[model samples]
Target chain A: MDIWFFLIQVLNGLQYGLLLFLVASGLTLIFGIMGIINLAHGSFYMLGAYLTFWLLQSVDSLLLAIVLALPISAAVGYLIEALLVRVLYRRDHLDQVLLTYGLILIFNEAQRMLWGGDVHGIKVPAALDWSIPLTDTLSYPVYRMAISAVCAALAVGMYLVIQRTRFGMWIRAGASNRDMVAALGINVNLLFGAVFALGAVLAALSGAIAAPISSIGPGMGDTVLIICFVVVVIGGVGSIKGAFLGALLIGLADTFGKVLAPDFASFSVYAVMAAVLLVKPRGLFA
Target chain B: MTTFIAGTGLHTYYGSSHTLHGIDFAVRRGETVALMGRNGMGKSTLLKSLLGIVNPRQGKVTMNGADVTGADTHAIIRRGIAYVPEGRGMFHNLTVREHLVMSARPGNDGRRDWTYERILETFPRLAERLGSLGTHLSGGEQQMLAVGRALMTNPDLLILDEATEGLAPLIRREIWHVIRSIKETGIASIIVDKNVNVLLGLADRHVILVKGEVVYDGSDLTPESEILKRHIGV
Candidate 1:
C-alpha cells in the first residue's frame, strides 16, 4: 500500500477511536460511579440518530438538530434514572442486568414503531461536504476530520472537568465511597441523575455525528454497544484515561484487520481484548 | 445549651440481628461527647442511626427540635454535621487537596469559619502533601487529613469514628491535639476511640454502650470508676 493510503487508513482509525471514546467514557462513568450496569445506554445512541433524522425534516442544520436533541436525551436519561435506575442501585447486579436488558427490548420496539424497519441516511451538511487532497488520485473527507477534532476537544473538556472542577471531584470521590460523599453534604442521588443524563448526551452526540457517514438503520446501536463494552473491559471499569487508550487500540485493530485479513475482521477487536486481559486481569487501569 | 441532635427509642437492626436497642442519645451544641464501648457494643450503630446511615427499624432522630427521622443522609449532613467515618473513609483516587476542596462548604448558618487556608495552617503536614493521593498518606497523616476534611465543611458537629485507630503513639497525640483545638473553636464533636484516658480529658460528657444498650451516661466518670471497668473493660 502507498504511504498516503496508509496515512488515510490511520486517520480513519483515529476518527473511529475518538467516536468510540465518546460513548465508552460515559458508559464507564455510569458503571464506575453509580454502580449501575446500563445495557440501555446504546439505545440513547440509536435514539440520537433517530431524533436528529426526525428533526432534520423540520430543521435544516445538523448542528441545530443535535443541540435540540441533547437536552431531550438528557431529560429522558434523568427520568429513567429517577423512575427505573434508582431502584436498582440497592439491588444486586443480576437484577440490574435483567431490568436494563428489558429496557433494550423496549427501546428497540419503540424505535421500530416510530421510525419503521428501514435503512436511512443523513445528508452531510453542505458546509462540511468537502475533502482535502492527500494525493493526486486520493483525498480525505473533511467531515471525518471534523468529527475527530470535536471528539478530541470534548475528551479534553471532560478531563478538565473531572480533574479541576468541584463537581468532577465529587464524581471521582463518589466512585470510591457513596456514603462518604453524601456525608460531605453533596446530594448523591441528584449527582447520579446528572451523570446518567450526561452519559446519554454523550452517546447521543456520537450517534448524531456518525449518522452523516454511516447508514442509519434499526439495531445500529447493538454493534456499537458490544464494541463499547469491549473498550470498557480493556480500559478498566472506571478509568477514563484507560478508555481513551483502549478505544484507539480497538479502532486501529478493527480498521486494519479488514484491510489485512478480511475474514478475521470481526474477531480482531475481541482478540485484542483477550490479549490485554491476559497481561492485566483487572484491565489496564482498574 | 441547645441539643444539636437527639435520638430516642432508636431500634436499629442488621438483617434480623438487633444492634441499637431503643437507645436514647443526644449531643448538645458546642459540646464534645465521647461514645465509648468495646467492639460490637452498638456505639457505631447509634451514630449511624443518628446520621441516617442505617435506617432504624423504629426510632425518631431530631435535629434542633425538628423531626428529621429518615431524612436523606446528605440532607441531614447539610444541617452542619460532618463525619470522619471508621477506617478514615479515604478516597484513593482523590488528592489531599481534592479531598479538602470538595468538602469545603459554609456552615448551615452561613459561617465560612473553616477555610482551606486555615485547615492547611492547622495541619501543616497535610499542606506539605497536598498533591499526594489519600492512599499514599501514612496512617497518622491519613487521620489528620480525615479531621482536616471534616473541618473544611465548617460543621456545627464533627463525628470521628475511630479517628486515631491503628496509628503510632506520636500520631495519636497529634490527632488528640487537633481535636482539643477543634473543641476550643466551639464545634461540637462525637469521638469514638479506645483511648479512654485521652477522651476523659477531651469529652465534656460520656455515654457508654454495652451490647446495644447505654449502661452509662454522665459527666463525672473517671479513670478509676467501677462502671468504666465493668462496661468498657478499661
Candidate 2:
C-alpha cells in the first residue's frame, strides 16, 4: 500500500478504537463493579443514535441534539437499574443473562415501534463538513477526526473521575467489599444507580456521535455489543485500562484485516481474542 | 445510660442452619460491650442481626428508641454506627488514603469528632503508608486501617469483629491501645475478640454466647469467672 493509504488506514483504526473504548469502558465498569452482565448495554448506544436522530428534527444543531440526548439516555439507564437490574444483583449469572437478554428483545421492539424498520442517515454538522487533505488527490473527512478527538477527551475525563475523585474511590471500594461500604454509612444502592446512569450516558454519547458517520439502522447495536464483549474478555473483566488497550488492538486488527486478508475479515477479530486468551486465561490485566 | 443499639429476641438463620436464637443484646452510650463465644457460636450473627447485615426472623433492633429492624444496612449504619468486620474488608484497588477519605463524614448528630487528621494522628503508621493499597499493608497495618477507616466516619457507635484476628503480639498490643483510647473518647463500641484477658479489663459489659443463645450477660464477672472459662475456653 502507498504511504498516504496506510496513514489513512491507521487514522481510521485509531478512530474506530476510540469509539469502541467509549462503549466498552462502560461495559467493563458495570460488569466489574456492579457485577451485572448487561447484554443490553449496546441498546443504550442504539437509543442514543435514535434519540439524536429524533432530536435533530426539532433542533437545528447536531451538537445540541447530542447534548440533549445524553441525559435522556442516563435517565433510561437509572430507571432500568432501579426497576429491573436491582433485583438481579443477588441472583445468579444465569438469571442476569435471561433478564438482560429479555431486555435486549424489549429494546429492539421499542426501537422498531418508535423509529420503524428503516435505515436513516445523518448529515455531518456544517462546521465539520470539510476534509483535511492528506495528499493532492486524497483527503480525510474532518468529522471522523472530530469524533476521535471527542472520544479521546471523554476518555481522559473518565480516567480523572474514576482515579481522582472521592466518588471513584467509593466505587472501587464498593466493588471490593459491598458490605463494608454499607457499614461505613454510604448508600450503596444510590452509588450503583449513579454508576449505571453514567455508563448509559457514555454508551449513548458514542452512538450519538457515530450516527453521522455510520448508517443508523436496526440491529446496529447487536454487532457493536458482540464486539464490545470481545473487547472486555480480551482486556479482562472490570479493568478500565484493559478495555482501552484491548479496544485499540481489536480496532486495528479489524481495520487492517480487511485490507490484508479480505476473505477472513470477520474472523480476524476473534482470532486475536483467542490468541490473547490462550496466553492469559484470565485476560491481559486480570 | 441511654441505649445506643438494642436487639431483642433475635433469631437469625443461614439456610437450614440456625445461627442466632433468642439473643437479646444491648449497648448503651459510651459503653464498650465485648461479644464473646467460640467459633460458630453466633457472636458475629448477633452483631450482624443488630446492624441489619442479616435479617433476624424474629427480632426488633432499635437505635436510640427508634425501631430499625429489617432496615437497609447503610440506613441502619447511618444512624451513627460503624462496623469493622472480620478479615479487615480491605479494597485491594484503593490506597490507605482513599479508604479513609472516601468514608470520612460527620456523625449522625453532625459531629466531626474523628476527622481525617485525627485518624492519621491516632495511626501514625498508617500516615507513613498513605499511598499503599489496603491489601498491601501488613496484617497489623490493615487492621489499623480498618479501625481508622471506621473512625473516619465519626460514628457514635463502632463495632469491631476479630479486629486483631491474625497479627503480631506488638501489633495486637498497639490495636488494644488504640481501642482503649477510642473508648476514652466516649463512643459506644461492640467488640468481638478471642482475647478474653484484654477484653476483661476493657469492656464495660460482657455478653457470652453458647450455641446461638446468650449464656451470660453482665459486667461483674471477674477474669477467672467460670462463665468465661466454660464458654470461651480463655
Error of 2 at B214 (Å): 2.0
Candidate 2, residues A1-286: lDDT per residue as tens digits?
Answer: 9999999998898899999999999999999999999999999999999999999999999999999999999999999999999998999999989999998999999999999999999999999999999899989999999999998998999999899999999898888988788888888999999999999999999999999999889998888999999999999999999999899999999999998899999999999999999999888897
Report the C-alpha lDDT of model 1 over B31-86, residue by residue, as the tens digit.
99999999999988898999999999898999999988999999999998999999
Point to the candidate with the largest lDDT: 1
- Model 1: per-residue lDDT, tens digit, A23-93? 99999999999998989899989989999999999999999999999999999999999999999998999
Q: Which regions of candidate 2 deviate over 4 angstroms?
A: none
Candidate 2 lDDT score relative to the true structure: 0.93
Backbone clashes counted, model 2 = 0
Q: Which ten residues in a row have the lowest lDDT in candidate 1 chain A?
A: A215-224
lDDT of 2 by residue, B1-234 (tens): 998889998999998899888888889999999999999999888888998889999989999999999999999998898899999899989999999999988887888999889899999999999999999999999999999999988888899999989899999999999999999999999999999899989999999999999999999878778877888886
